[model samples]
Target: MAQLSDDCFAFGGDLMPVHAALDLLRSRVAPVTAAETVPLADALGRVLAEDVVAPFDVPPHDNSAVDGYAVFFDDLQADGETVLPVTGRVAAGHLLGREGRRGEAVRIFTGAPMPAGFDTVLMQEDCRPIKDANDGDSVAIPAGIKRGANRRKAGEDVTRGSVVLATGRRLRPEDVGLAASLGRKELSVRRPLRAAVFSTGDEVREPGQELPQGCIYDANRFALIAALRQLGCAVTDLGILPDRLEAITEALERAAAEHDVLITSGGMSTGEEDHVKAAVEALGALHFWRLAIKPGRPVALGQVRDAVFVGLPGNPVAVMVTFLRIARPILLRLMGAEESEPRLFPVKAAFAYKKKAGRREYVRARLARGEDGALTAVKHPRDGAGVLSSLVESDGLVELPEDLSRLEPGMTVEFLPLSEVR
Candidate 1:
């Protein structure tokens, strides 16, 4: 286990641009988790700590790409058909017993290693089995086939001594498969980040508990927990804490000593009942990063003792947006993973919209394919930060850049698909 510096998130700014805030996080944050080796089955979603080198070339030998007859290209007639004796046969994992001579075809199947003196293959369908003058096995081949056709060269997919997987990569299924291809039974990866998540507010209550007169069920805590798990963190559900400075401070101090991160929604706003900010400031340092982004503007980044503290807005939509765009990058860096921002794709806008200049906005939108097969983004009807249903009904967000103040129909926009974050 490792710990972050006390002043890692001490940078101060007001109404910082989204890019500037991200740049700060990237510059300040580093991995705090230790490395350990795990079996390939348990390595998925874990951050790789070592670079993997290919010990040998993929395929290991020149093989046929399809079931066909392997022969020297020169053996075929230039403009007509030529008959040749079928001397031997080869299948996957098998090789020709003897060297093949020119003007002879050898039966070969897909993945079968090509024999010596064979450079081209003709599909079995194109060649006709016929009888030669000796009445032995023979085949008729056609012309116009190129040299070295249907032959997969050694190292075609991966070369020996090449770095197949790099350090700090979050292991995906394909990454695991590549390691298996290299005969690796286990991989060295960074341990999962231990995280504690909670929500605060006197008006919030548990879902299963009896409904109070003017209270809403806690949703932010559950949502944050799910998001943290999706990022491969081992989350501790700290439950809901009332708006009391003593209780919040006690929980934060205890959790920070055991976890790598402490996440909470609500009680971040500056109000009389918002004791979270005061409690965090008492135990460690706290900084409010007022980003110039729509829906999610007031993001709190700081440290609770050695553990990183993330205070997100109470609104459901804002919590998700800030987590995806802001906190996600910070958490990934702390997990020893490389920067992997979700990719945004360009699509034509199906609705017109406008926003203030110099502020980035992410509009919830669904994608629709037009008759011409082009994708168009349809904005959701609701744009409130508290509208959790809007996020559920939408596919992803239509990102409006800081310089773009107005948008019209058919205009191109970048879309961040929800799947990318998951």
Candidate 2:
């Protein structure tokens, strides 16, 4: 369970900006503080509970970067071609027998440690070997090559006792590989947050079931389950709940007792069929009623016992938009993940759009490369929140800030790709 600061919701007004609401949401919830050890094979997508310190230097020794000939810089001829006897061979994982005298070269392969007293390397391509046996295998190299040009220094990537990873970092593929490089067989990470997801509506039915008159198939719950799973949550699909306060409240109470969060769709509004808001109010507390955002204005946030609750609109596009913009960050914080804003890339807009100045809006847009070969975001043909096909047809969302009211073609705007938030 987590606690919030008392003044987290002090907006001093009815509606708040998107950033303001996000900051308030973040200020209230605390990250899960429990940890469990898991093997590195199962560490991907999990948040680290503690900082990981490197045990030793990455390479452990100075090594050659390429297959070349190792030589002492001082042994080279000052003004002319220098010839040296190929005294011994040093292969990777194998060492040379002894140090060579003046005017001598040692054949070295990639990843082989720099031999004693050797300070320079010459690629085999630049050296010509003499065929005469009297010289006992010799190479002639030109003078004036720089010292230490083809060597990789030890501790270049990671030094001993350095912090390799910070706490609350969501482990990516490269991060996992780094732990492996530090000789870590297991990582301590926060346990996945348990989420109970469902929907409430008499007009909604499962996709495989026969649709009744004036009813549509439920898509939000399925999509929500997938998104939660992507965020490394243990998701339990609770199916659809009937449009009754008792049924929704009972289900939410039971879920709150066993899970870390309860997520429901389509019942936060004031319609006669809406019961999720009432159910949460009866069992726990409702912290927020709506966000000042178009397409998904009726989003709700609350808590039931120790479990947090999120209520989303019924429109498919709005559901996706609100979840990405609002619920995703909150869920991540609850799972002990470090806060990270979704990445936004600046691109030119190819379509014109007009939106209200008071509400934050996200337009479904497809990206196209112009004749100048720059990516330009084009708004989808339809802007209806219920149009689920727009999400599939478009590449991502073009975010319009609250202060701006007009968008002209070729104007620079921030484009957020769909894959980034996921």
Q: Which structure among the candidates has the greatest lDDT?
A: 1
lDDT for each residue of candidate 2 in 302-354, tens digit (9 for 90 to 100)? 89988899899889999999999999988889988886578989999998888
Per-residue lDDT over 1-422 for candidate 1, one digit per residue giving the tens place of the 0 to 100 score = 65655532223455778888888777777799999999998999999999999999997899999998999888888999989999889999988987779978999999999898898989999989987677799999988899999999999989999999999999889999999988999999999999999998888899999988998888888888898998899999999998899999999999999999999898876668888888889998865446788888768788999999988888899999999988898899999987558899999999999887887899999999976799999999999899999999999999999999999999999999999888
Model 2 clash number: 0
The C-alpha stretches of model 2 lying farther than 4 A from their native spots are: 1-13, 77-81, 97-102
**What Cα-based lDDT does every candidate model obtain?**
0.89, 0.88
Query: If scored against the real structure, what TM-score would every candidate get?
Result: 0.93, 0.92
Alpha carbon lDDT at 420, candidate 1:
89
Candidate 2 residue 30 Cα shift, in angstroms, is 0.8
